[model samples]
Structure formats: structure tokens, C-alpha cells
Target: MIIGYARVSTLEQNEALQTDALDKAGCERLFTDHASGAKAHRPELDRLLDVIRDGDTLVVWKLDRLGRSVQNLVDLMNLLQSRGVGFKSLTENMDTTTPGGVLVFNVFAAMAQFERDLIRERTNAGLQAARARGHKGGRPSKLGDRERARIRELYQSRALTVQEIADQYHVSRKTIYSSIKNTR
Candidate 1:
């Protein structure tokens, strides 16, 4: 069976192009992921992975549709290969069932990994440059010092419930509990 996988990085992005392409390419079944490419969990992708069997073929419109990161794409490919499933990327013209296609996919996978490494390197360099300029990275605490102190007092007094404290402090119950736990 030739199973198709289509994905768009965001809710607003259209899945039409991929779907149409996959249809034209003769896919028998189709799955999709509507979340961002960087997200770790894609429900449709997971579902497809769970049911895909030996001798089945998985097809995608493009390499990016499979994954945004090199490690992710490589991992998916390895998993499919281990399960005796063949993979085909339309835009990249890769097919795991053929020897030449295997070589081409390998080279493409290497290049994707190299590109990701370069992105990481550049990001680290940028962060280091920002730090040298005395720009902190993380967001400041949402609660003011005085409010935190008051929260600690109220929590230690045992006069307020977690929910009440959260209400008074204008924060979530989880945040209130975390604050109390941290102070203790």
C-alpha cells in the first residue's frame, strides 16, 4: 500500500498542496499533522507509525513534511526501515525501496544534519554575543518580591487555601503551590 503523509506547520497553513500532490502520486491512504514542525508530538504521525506494517510504502510530498529537524527525520526513516516499510519523498525524489534511491536519501539526510548543526552553532554564537552585552535570556519573575514575601506569609499562616492564595495573588493554583513549596 502507498500511504501518504501530509503536514503544514501551523493551523493557518493549507494542507491542499500536499494532499493534491500525494493524490496525483497515487497514494492509497493519507495522514496529516497540523501542528508546528518543531513540535515533538504529531498525533497523525504517531497514528500512522503505529499501524504501518512490513511491505507497506509511506509517501510524503516533501522532506520537510516528514520533519523539521535532521535527527527527527533520520529517526523516523530508521524506524520505518527497521519495520520493513519503504519511504518516498516526492520533492526530494527519494525512494528507500531502490538502491540508488537509498544512496540519494542518505546523502540528503547527511546534508540535513549538517544544516541543523550549523543552525545550532549560529544560535549559540548569538546567545553568547547577547550575554556579552549584558542581556539576560529568561523572562523575569512574574510575582514581585513583596508579593512573593506576602504569599509566603499567607501560606505559612495556613489561613488560606491554595486556590484562595492563587486568587489573591492573581496567579494559577499551581504557581501558588509551587511558590509555597519553594519557600519551604
Candidate 2:
């Protein structure tokens, strides 16, 4: 069975072109999604995956219509291959059933991995630079030194529960615990 999947970003966008292409490509079953490609969940796509089985080919009008990101596309491709299902993209002329197609898909997957590594490297470098300037990341601490000291004093006295100290400072018990951890 050849199943087709089509998507449009919003209700206002039309999937007619995609559907038409899939129809022309001899898709026996079709699923349509009226959600953004970036969205993690698509009910129609999920349903299509649930019903598809080995020897079935999954077709999409374009690569972008089938995935939220390059990594997502690569992951999906690997999943389909593991399930013994083939993948075909109309625009990219990708067909996992062929040797050339498999090579192309692997190249795309490698590129996605390369892109992720570059992003991770750049982010680490930027953080290192910021640290050199004494700039810290993450949410600003809610309580100051006085508040932390008071919390420690109250905690040592055992007169107040951690929750009580947290309520007084408008912070979480975890914050109180962290303060305690840092103090000691």
C-alpha cells in the first residue's frame, strides 16, 4: 500500500497542491494535517503511522511537509527503514527503496548531525565567552545574601519548617534547600 501525507501550516493554508501531487503519484491512502510542521503532534500523521506496516511505502509531497526539522526527518527516515517501510518524497525525488535514494538520505542525515554539532559548539563557545566577562546564565536568584542567611539561621534553629521559610521568602522549598546546600 502507498500512503500519502500532506500538511499545511494553518487552517487558512491549503493542502490541495500537495494532495494533488500525492494523488498523481498513485497514493492509495491519504492523511492530511492542518497544523504547523514545527508542531510536535499531528493527529493525522500519528494515525497514518499506526496503520502503516512493512512493505508499505510512505509518500509526502515534500520533505518539509513530513517533518518539523532536519533531525526529525532523519529520525523518521531511520524509523521507517527499521520498520521495513519505504519513504518517498515527490519534490526531492527521494525513494528509500533505491540505492541512490538511500545514499542521498544518508547525506541529508549527516548534514543534520553536522548542523547540530556546529550549533552545540557555538553555544558552548558563547557561554565560555560570557563566563570570561563574569556573566552568568539562568534565572536570577530570587533571594539575596540577607535572605539566605536568615533562612540558614531559621533552618538551624529548627523553629520553622523549610516550607515556612520558603513561604516567607516567596520562594520554593527547593530554593531553601539549595541555599542550605550552598551555605554548608
Q: In angstroms, what RMSD does candidate 2 have relative to the true structure?
A: 1.3
Residue 177 lDDT in candidate 2: 100
Each model's TM-score, in the order given? 0.65, 0.94
On residues 70-158, what C-alpha lDDT tens digit does candidate 1 reach at each position? 78888899899899999999998889999998898788779978888999999999999999999999987678767778899988899
lDDT of 2 by residue, 8-120 (tens): 99999899999999999999999999998888989999999899899999999999999999999999899899999999999989999899999999999999999999999
How much lDDT does each candidate structure score? 0.89, 0.94
Model 1 residue 169 CA deviation (Å) reads 1.2
Superposed by TM-score, candidate 2 places the C-alpha of residue 99 at a distance from the truth, in angstroms, of 0.5
On a 0 to 100 scale, what is the lDDT of residue 12 in model 2?
Answer: 94
Pairs of residues at least 3 apart in sequence or in different chains that clash in candidate 1: none
Where does candidate 1 stray beyond 4 Å?
1-51, 59-75, 89-92, 181-184
